[model samples]
Target: MKNALIIALGIITGAIVIGGQSFYHLLTSQNIVNVASGEVRLGEVYDEQLTTTVTIIGDDNETPILTITDATDQIVKDVKQELAQMVVDANKTLSAHEKMRLETAYFDTNVNIELSTEVEYHSQYQKDMQLTIDETELSHHASEQYHFAEAVDMLNTYASKMDTIYHQNDSFIHKT
Candidate 1:
């Protein structure tokens, strides 16, 4: 009986030790898994933030430029149609030179209005881009700042071209 009791006690003690070790291992492995999962979540969050920022900047830079370009194209088409109609309706008795002068005057007066409006819109776009660049400069990310700078430079170049067109048109109008 005494031998049986000793055997039972040994078995119980061994089971306790094994169970305790297993519990300890489980806790440590679970902690490691949790830490790894947390890091992965953090990485996902960081990527999401970068993607969102880039998308916002792209939209802000591209949308207005496209809108203005489309508007300018439409205005040009309308002006051409109007000028062609005017030429068609011009008095048949006028000399070709006189007719040309009259057409030039009409185009200068009417087209200038459209050009001026476009220039004004482009100028406002430039200002808005400058503001976006200024705001982006406050961010810690260098990539974002670089992108904004590039966008601003492109806007400046486009604005300069528009200005040149307006000036050329103005000079021609004055000469006529």
Candidate 2:
């Protein structure tokens, strides 16, 4: 009877361990699915926003500005490619901790992309505003010059912030 009791307990413990492992795997698989879906949605939103912004900016007939836009698009594509690689890496990993780390990384990269887009938009807006100020025959020439200077200052500040973010992101990617 004593031997039987010990054997029963061993069977029960084995079953419990197997069950727990299966449940963990199920959860992790579901998490990957969710992350993949979220990535798709993010990409869709980003593409739409990029198209709209480019359309608005491209309305201007400045060749240099068009070149800048093309460069900006390339930068955005590079960032997105980095993010796609992260997703692929995450999918290949079976470790829960690794997956969580990748998820955090994915979120951080998205934030960086959004910030870069915003900075670009602000810089473009400032430039457009400055151009308008230049073209207009304002009676208050001094005030117009002051506003133009302010716009340039704001653009410079945005450019500086973007540079900082780019460096930080580069270091972060290297660390990971």
Candidate 3:
């Protein structure tokens, strides 16, 4: 009976593993194909925090400034979504460890709007868009420094290559 039970457990585990891999493959294969074919554009992902200023009309009321700020926030949100998708697609080819590292990583952007009286009536407000990513913690441990360094290099190389590929061709194969 014990031997039979052990065999059953092994069979179940095997089935689960196979099923999980199949599901993962199904989910990731299309993204891999899309990215490889350049159907997905990853050049829009900013490497670091980006700050831009958009001017608004100077007026005593703050609604216009808020509106501009909200729009800028939406733009940042869109960029973030693009970046996340790029990461997901790129990670499909990475090892389990590398994918885990990237999955744990975080990126954030903030938009700040300020009224500028110095500007003329047509452009009286300025909005600042900031994007930020923190990697210090990932490399803080002495034992893990090398791993983090490699991960950073890998990610940078992938991003640069993808960005170039995205801009240069509409349907080029992913060389990386």
Candidate 4:
């Protein structure tokens, strides 16, 4: 009877240790995005992963912060790619002089908007953290939520302007 009790306690302790380790790893670990190869396409891939990480971290509030940060970085790169592409496409339609002017305008606009959105995102994140600190001190989830929201809003705003910008480019095309 004594031996059986000892074995049972050992088994329970072992299970707990294993379970704790698995939980710890899940909370702290994340999939790395490898953009160095120049193979990863932007948009859906980053969005899906970000969504999953956000959901996981929000559920447990223990997920790694790097995942969100990396995703945000990638989204910024994607936005830059988009703005660059706009310049490339406009070059095909407008004269060299017109292209220069329009591209410069787009570039300045992109820079301003990107900087402004990032500032707003950080502000929202800090606000969220302050609110959480008054309660549970959990911040990663809040940061992810605000960052994701800001990114989507920024993207949508950029997309909406694309039509108008392209129309202006078309007008220049017809003029020349």
Candidate 5:
């Protein structure tokens, strides 16, 4: 029957979704993925190709340099995993939909940090220490900008449940 087939599809789709979630949790239970990439673009308007280079003069000391590059460093995976678990434990009281939507939204934000820097060291210093960033670097913090909008719907109705879920005073409460 048409109705029977529709029901079967729904059930199959739901099972697939749950299984996919379980698999994702299993893989990410201990760690999550963070990748580094560049953010470089040539303007859409152009008449011809262009490449420009400028030279700078400096003493044996502090100086500023301008360069175009795309590189990334990572934060520790365990720290990120712990944060994810904390967030999950924090919001477990939410319905499955609420929990997933919020987590997805949050994870999207905390990963990439981009900006610009001008470094100068008159004396010897570690390369990492010389790093600097300008306001333009953080062009996107999607998770922060949205700020738990997905879970807003459930807060009033499920506050008590959420409180109970996030209560980490005892390990048993969040064990499974």
Candidate 6:
């Protein structure tokens, strides 16, 4: 009975040590992003045995703070990719003439509207965030529920414009 008890205790301790090591490994990986104030994101990749975190810094209670977590890198990367593609698609939607016009007026207007929508939603919805861009600080004001995800959705709508432009561009040919 004494030997059995010792064996069980050893097994349990070993298991705990292994589990702790696994968790530590996940946390140390740069994939984790922790925020100071707003919503922090975390992801558990069971197959890869990885945990990722992303931190969004924004204003909360009129000051900056940090919210720590393991899940934001993917989201921001995703947003950047989507938005960049959106910019391309938006440009693609114009005929040479229309595209020429957009270069001056419509492009800037649309970008402003989309940026306003995204910034407002992303800033307000996240409580206690340190809002900064390119390391520059941002001030905060109360706004109703401006969902960032929704704003991204709105931005993505611009992609449809690409199809419109393509149809009109005589330079484009569908080889297939």
- Name the best candidate (by TM-score): 2
Q: Which residue pairs come into collision in candidate 5? A: 114-137, 115-137
lDDT of each: 0.32, 0.32, 0.36, 0.34, 0.34, 0.35
Q: Residues 79-103, candidate 3, lDDT per residue (tens digit)?
A: 3344456568767998987773434
lDDT of 1 by residue, 105-148 (tens): 32211010111222221121122110010011111233233332
Q: Which regions in candidate 6 have their CA more than 4 angstroms from the true location?
A: 28-37, 42-132, 135-176
Model 4 lDDT per residue over 61-152, tens place? 35521222223235445544544555577678888677643224322211112111111111211221100101112223332333333444
**Residue pairs in clash, model 4:** none
| Model 2 Cα shift for residue 124 (angstroms) | 40
Clashing pairs in 3: 49-131
Give stretches of model 2 more than 4 Å off: 32-176
Backbone clashes under 3 angstroms, per model: 0, 0, 1, 0, 2, 26
Q: Under the 3 Å rule for N, CA and C atoms, how many clashes does model 3 have?
A: 1
- lDDT winner, 3 or 6: 3
Instruction: For residues 63-114, write the lDDT of model 2, one tens digit per residue.
Output: 3111123232344443334444646665576565555332234221101011
Candidate 3 lDDT at 10 equals 100
TM-score of each: 0.21, 0.28, 0.23, 0.24, 0.22, 0.23
Question: Cα deviation in Å at residue 23, candidate 6?
Answer: 2.4
In model 5, which regions exceed 4 Å deviation?
1-72, 76-83, 101-103, 107-176
Please tell me which model should have the higher lDDT, number 4 or number 6: 6
Misplaced by over 4 Å in model 4 are 1-70, 101-103, 107-176
